[model samples]
Every structure is written in C-alpha cells, then in structure tokens.
Target: MREEKDARIIKREILPYLAPGIAKLLWGKDDKFFAGLEEIRLRIKSPLILKIGDRDYTINRRGEITTRLDDAYVVEGEDIYRSIASISDNSLYAFEEDIKKGFITIPGGHRVGLAGQVVYKGNNICILKNFSSICFRVAREIKGCAKGLLPYLIDKNGQIVNTLLISPPRCGKTTILRDLARMIADGIHIPFPHNVVIIDERSEIAGCYQGVPQLEVGVRTDVLDACPKALGMMMAIRSLSPEVIVTDEIGREEDIASIYECINAGVAVIATVHARNIEELERRVLFKELLKSKSFGRGVVLSRRQGPGTVEAVYRWDD
Candidate 1:
C-alpha cells in the first residue's frame, strides 16, 4: 500500500514532463482523453490500481485492468474473479490473460507495463503472460531523421552506398534506420535502391500490426521479428538475397560473427551499437571483428548536443 502511494506521487510529479507526441496521445490536443480518463475513475473496484495522466488510483478488485476502461483499461468480463469463482481454482489465469493483451497508455503516450512468465526457447521469446504493472517507454516518430547524416554516408550513387550509425541508449539509431529504410525502399533519387531486410529483434521498427506496419517504412522492406541478428542475417542472405542488411544495436558475440560473414559474402551492412565515441567503442572486443583501427568503414556518431538524433561525427576507415 505504501509503495503504491509513492508511485502515485511520482506519477503526478512526472505528468508535466511528457514528450510532445505522447502528451497528444493520452490527453489529445483538446484534452478529451484526459477528461475521459477522469470520469472512468469512478467505476474501478478494489485490488486494481489505476494510474492515468496526473494521478494514480487503485481498483478494488484483481481484474480492474480491464474493468477500468474509461481511464486506463477496458474490462473484458464481469467484476467477479472468474478463476477464483470456482472455489477450488486459485490460479488467476483468466485475469492474467486480459492483462497481457491490454496496453498501458500513459499520459505522455509513454506506457509502463506488466506481463506474466516470459516464455522462451533458447534465445527466442515465444510469448509473455500473467500481469502486474505496465509501462510504455513512450513512442515517437521523427521525420527527416537521417537527413543530417546523409552527406557523410551517401556516395556518387546518391545512396549511402554503405555506412553504419552508432549511438548509446535512446540516441535515435533506430529512428535513423527507420527513415533510411523508408527512404531506401522508396528508391530515393539516390540511385538504384535494393530490397532491405530488417532483423527487428524487438518489433519496434515497422511495428507491424495486423500484418501492416504501424510505423512508416518504405514499401520494399521485409522484416523478421524477435529473431537474433545472426540467424536473421543468414536467413535474409539465403531467402531475401537483399542488397543491404540493416539492423539496430549490434554488439553481441554472435552479432560480430554474423556481420563478418555478411561482409565477406559481399552484402553491405548498416548497423548501430551502444558507444559514446569511436575511441571509446574500439575498446569493446566484439568490434574488433568488424572495425580495424584505421581500416574501418564509415560510421555516424549520435549525441544529445547534436540534437536528439543529432549526427555528432562521421568516421571513415583508412581503407
């Protein structure tokens, strides 16, 4: 109870700081969402905790995530706990199912979230289930995202030809990739654009929903969701035979190995890694496989001063 109260206070304090896009999402420019959410507060029962735009409230029941739709969730069933209704059945399976499927849309369009046991096989995540808290980090789309870095990358062909973008944490590597993918797939005046295969490890790119992409990427792009980079690269090489391979945040042992093979196979690679500066990045052992001290390929560095996805610097290999 004490913890929940603390969280509520935090929620209120942070409400004013939501991102521009996210603020529009939950509350809308007219504040309709905010008002709608407020009215829904009256319906929540016990055991269900609700955190909307500026405040946090709790439900009186366990299945409140679904029941508290006006503000946060849209309930799927009766107020009574179905799993516990059977007397002998104590498992909260029914309630858990709704929680997994429902989304937590916070005020800034940022969403915090919860889930059940993350089912996995080897490195593959099969599914997520059960439920507790939910948080959506918030989603934003930047236009002309890669325009700043194009000059350093594009060649006589007008296309980047071959290049890599590097960044640390939320520096916008993926955003650049998304714009580049869209631009490339559309066959920008930049010469012959070829097919692109995106190994989206986290369904963020192209955000395919109902078989369609929630995010705007070019038409010629194909994506593999949740698969590791190496396996996806190998698959693209064989099946898609793409002209270029693009992916985000690469630096694993397997990632280095796969990229090396891709380079050897004569496939151009566009990838990013979490590094502050090239000097700082070279220290990482995995990079040795892709970048040699002076003979490294071109790279784009991102930093806050440069802007959210600002291009800090570009490096070209001695080769």
Candidate 2:
C-alpha cells in the first residue's frame, strides 16, 4: 500500500542524485536494501553508511558488505558536488535559503542533509559552503498510519479537536503529523473534510518541491512550505481559512503565541513538540503556560520502545 510508494521515491526521486558508483552499489544490493533503507550517509573520504531500521551498515565501493574502515569507499568531494547539482537542479542560488537551513528537499519529498562551512553575515547564517557530507533521508507516507489515532482526535460531533503530538527526536512526529494532515483534509472517516493548512517550516512535512508538494498530503491540504511556523500559522489563519492547522515541532515562544492566536481565531491546531512524556513537556519553561491553560485538548506521546510512532500514552485536558 503506502509502503510501496516510499520504495518508488528512493528509486525515482533519490537515486538520480547519488554518484554513479554509490547508486550502482545500492542498486546491486537488491530491493531489500531500498525497502529497509532509512538514511544514506555520505561523507568525504569516509565510509558510505546506510541506516536500516535501528542499525547502521557500511558498504564498500563495490557495494559489498564491509565493516573495516579502510575497506569502505571514501566519498570524494566531487560526489558531493554532483549530488548538490542534482538536488538543486544546477541552480544553487535558487535554494540558497534552504541551504542555510542545513537541508534541501529534492523532487520526491526526500531531504538531503547538508554539512560544511558556515558563511555568516553579521549574526545570521548566510549560506553553507564547501559541503563535505550529504545525508539522504527518505520521505515515507504511511497512508493509514494515523487511522488508529484519529478517533482520539475527534468528538461525537465529528469535529476535529486540538491535539499535540509529543516525541523526542527521530521518533516519527513529523511522519504522524503528515498522515494526520491527509486524513483530516481528505475526511477519512469524518462526515466532512476539514480544511487543513500545514506550516512546513522545515519542508519536511509536505516536502514541497518548487512550491508543489511531492508527497500526497491531500486534495484539501494547503502547505506553507519552508515558511517560519509563527508567520505561516498567522498567514494561514489570515488567508487560507483552515479548520485545522497542522505543523511540526513547536517549542519557541513565538510558536506558542501563534498557536494561541490560531485557537483564539477558532482554529484547531495539531502540532508536535520534543518531550519524552507529558510530565517532561509540562516541566519545560516554554511549554508551562500553554500546558497550564490546556490550550491543546489532547496530547499524544510517542516513544521508540516498540520502534518509532509507538503511542505510549494519550492525555486529555479537562477544561
């Protein structure tokens, strides 16, 4: 189902950016390599590593299994150059802003993590130059992954509820957020579709390529790709008239204020934050006021105990 779509992204969207030798190695490894692949790490003169599930494996130049540091292919500077060229479509200036963000979203919603020297203009990061590494993160859309969680986010009136998804890094908060957007926007089991606006500050949620979402968010979803969450949320409320505004990883003070504004305007928000559990989330200084007010009606905590997206517990605010 949805798993098959992600596999195609790797081949059609991601493979073209890879250097010839590395791509060939990955291709020769079999479909399992692509199926299980989560990340591909390429560093200058370093081992070519692939993250599969929770484990990492080093592959040699010939795509053979290799653990020895010396046996692994030493990624060169040219490999990075070619990758940047392919990801940016030979127009690096067009993606200059994304480069400053430390990543670029290519054609298939996949993100390429950039690393190199920081060029600063005053206190702000102007750009990243002399790139030495590229980490490919595969974008996956589990169509019905959020189906089990949707019931908790709805009331008897069939209206969407304000919810927050809490999870630590690499715990699939963005993935769940993306799926939820699709369901809410397209009206999975709901009687009517809710207008969903996604504030994709990192371009990870919607994976917009050239302003068009590469991932299937939904027919009704509106995405403010690569826009700051605070500004984007305000913009969505002011213009898009969304019933549910979805965004990832909200923690900053401005983000909190924007959420309040959205709620005040009668818009439900579904956002993610970094916390192990509700207790940890409440303890944080930035989240204290928001938690105290119970602005968010429901909170879902995720953990890696049973792997990413494992819903450990659900908390409801009694208001």
Candidate 3:
C-alpha cells in the first residue's frame, strides 16, 4: 500500500517535468505503469533499484553485484515505489555500471548505472546508503557526432589524417568517434582512403547492446564492442580488413601494443585518452609511448565547465 502510494506520488509529482510522451504514460494506469517511459526502461532491466540516498552500486556483466549498502529497495511492478522529498529530479547522471568501464547485463544485456555520493574509508571509497538523488543517462546512440571530425583526419595526399580526440567526461568525444567509424566505413573520400574498423573496448562508443550497434554508424563502420582495446585492434587487422582503427581511452600496455600493431600495418588510427593536456597523457606510461612513437597524428581534448555532460572545449593533440 505504501509503495503504491509512493508510485502515485511520483506520477503526480514528476509528470509535469517529463516530456509529453512520457507524461501521458505516467498518467495512464495499465498502460501508464507498463509502457510509460519510466516503466519501459525499468522493464528492460528487472529488479531495478533506484537509489534515494548518497552512494554507488554496480552489477557486473556476469550478474555479480557489489554495493556498499547491504540493502536497496527494488522496483518490480506497478505497486512498487519509494519517495525522496525535495530532491532535484532533472539532474543528468550515468548508471553505476559505467564505472566498471562496462554496461549492465540486465536480462538482455541492457545496462543501468547508479550515481550519488562517494563514501570514503581511508583509501577505500564506497557508495553511501543515503542517496538523495540518482542520475540515469540512458545509453542510446546518436550516430553523427563524429561526422565533423573526419575531414580533418583525411590528409591532402589521399590518405586518412591520423587524429586524436581528447575531452574530459561527457563532451561527446565518444559520440564523435562512433560517427567517424561510419564515415570511414562508408568509404570516406578523405585523403587517407581506407575502410574504418572501430575497436570499442567499452560498449559506450557503439552502444553495442546485442552484438549490434544501437546507433547508426553509416554503412561502412564495423564495430567490435566489449573487447579490450589491444585485442580488439588486432582482431580488426587480422579479420576486419580495416584501413583505420578507432577506440576510446588508451594508455594501457596492452592497448599501446595494439596501437603499434595498427601503425605497423600502415593503418591510420583515431582514439581518445583521459588527459587535461599533452602533459597529463605523459603521466601514464602508456601515453609516454604516444609521445615517443609520435604514433597518433592528432589529439582532441575536452573539458566540462560546471559538471558532467556539459561540453566545454576540444583540443587538438597534433596541433
């Protein structure tokens, strides 16, 4: 009964802020609780838990869960709900699964992440049990973020320009990379002419939910999601016949070797790394290789001014 009341309260309170399609569903009963945007997302992942305190929780690809709290309220069906008073409802955030650098394996591998407070215990940071709010960044795909970055990648001599895109947090760096793959795959008429192969270690870039791209990556991009960068790169070379290899977040031994492999094969590469500037990239041993090898031809760096998801700046590594 209390849960039902909470659900009703949420519907009454939240509908005003939701988009029209979602607001309509929240108002309807049978259809409301079933197909409404909120339920639609929850139905995709059973036993969904929305944190109402301050903390983080994670469910792995193998269905193993590790959370700081011993208990969490689960939302199973219509009559279930919980309420948090005076919490900001429009804040944007990502699910907890993203921290693992992986998406959730919900029944169909649909992922969910929880975000809130970080409780630290002397070198150990854990999520708090009192979550005042949560951020749900649905892992959907927009296939054209990379379209603008491709031309710069192709050099004047009919070869793809070596490029790097760097950005802090959510500046659409990955989104751009995804589109670049599509353009390359579609036989981008850049100076460097080659089909593109995407090495997507995390499901983020391609949003590969079911061994297929959730975003439109053009007709030519071939995506290898959920594999380590190194292995994925080699796989692209040995099997995919790619002229260009792209990936997100490099600076690992395994990843460096794969970058070397791509260059050795005379393939143009585009990838992103986490750094404020060329200096931070050097802090990581993996990045030092980039400086020494001069392997990556271009670099893009991003900054988030106020918070995550806010796009701030795009820096060129090659420049």
Index of the highest-lDDT prediction: 2
> Each candidate: what lDDT?
0.57, 0.87, 0.54
| Weakest lDDT window of 10 consecutive positions for candidate 3 | 79-88
Tens digit of per-residue lDDT, candidate 1, span 1-319? 4334433433453333333222223332223323323212112132333334334643322323233434543222232223112211344354343233343233322333444357767886554644322333434445577765655656655644456677777677887888888777777645667688888765566654333455677778888755678899999988998777888888789887788777777777788788888777878776754576332368888876644687888877734
Q: Give candidate 3's error at residue 162 in angstroms.
A: 2.6
**Model 2 alpha-carbon drift over 4 Å, by segment:** 1-6, 66-70
lDDT of 1 at 94: 40
Judged by TM-score relative to the true structure, which candidate is superior, 1 or 3? 1
Runs in model 3 deviating more than 4 A are: 1-102, 105-110, 114-136, 188-193, 305-319
Alpha-carbon lDDT of model 1 = 0.57
Residue pairs of candidate 2 with colliding backbone atoms:
none
Q: Please give the lDDT score for candidate 2.
A: 0.87
lDDT of 2 by residue, 61-136 (tens): 6668665767887888888888889888899999898899999888878899999999999999999999989999
Q: Candidate 3 residues 1-319, lDDT tens each?
A: 4345545544554444333432343354432232212212232123333232222443222333336323322333231112211122322233332333322322222243333356667875543434323333333334455555556666567677567776665555676676677767766545433577777776666666657766666576788877888888988899988878888887678877778888889888888877676677777776776766667666665554543223344434455
Global lDDT for candidate 3? 0.54
